[model samples]
Target: MNITISTFMKIAVTVIVISALLFSVGYQMVVDESNHYDSELDRYKNESLGR
Candidate 1:
């Protein structure tokens, strides 16, 4: 395969796209986990309201 400027650009673009996708997925997972923890904390707080 010939390594031209276009090839280099394509490779760079692919790497960037994959990196962005991974970051987005990881960020969303973190958000979901944080939300779950928050909900649990809220439930615990409500349960102890009368204490």
Candidate 2:
């Protein structure tokens, strides 16, 4: 099978776009989970100090 330059370029662009989207989604989820855990920890610390 002979692939032309235009087809190769299209495939490359598609791969790049998909990779960027997956990376962004994974990064956002990590940040959100970290923030949630941090807030929970702070709440626990405050409660312990009050007691």
Candidate 3:
């Protein structure tokens, strides 16, 4: 079993790309959900809306 430098580099790059993509997607989802919750809370607290 012989692994060349090219093959190792390709595998490493692929893993890094996939990891970055997954992290970005997950981070975005969390941020979006937090923003939505914050907006909803703000709307609920608005006293002018009681008019």
Task: Give the number of the best model, judged by TM-score.
Answer: 2
In the range 1-51, model 3's lDDT, one tens digit per residue, is 256888988999999999999999999999999999998888887855882
Per-residue CA lDDT of model 2 for 1-51, tens digit only, reads: 356888999999999999999999999999999999999999999999994
lDDT of 1 by residue, 1-51 (tens): 467988999999999999999999999999999999999999999889953
Model 1 alpha-carbon miss at residue 5, Å: 0.9
RMSD of each: 2.6, 2.4, 2.8
Q: Give the candidate order by descending TM-score.
A: 2, 1, 3
Candidate with better lDDT, 1 vs 3:
1
| Model 2 error, position 14 (Å) | 0.4
How good is model 2 by TM-score? 0.88
Which wins on TM-score, candidate 2 or candidate 3? Answer: 2
lDDT of 3 at 32: 100
- Supply candidate 2's per-residue lDDT for 39: 95
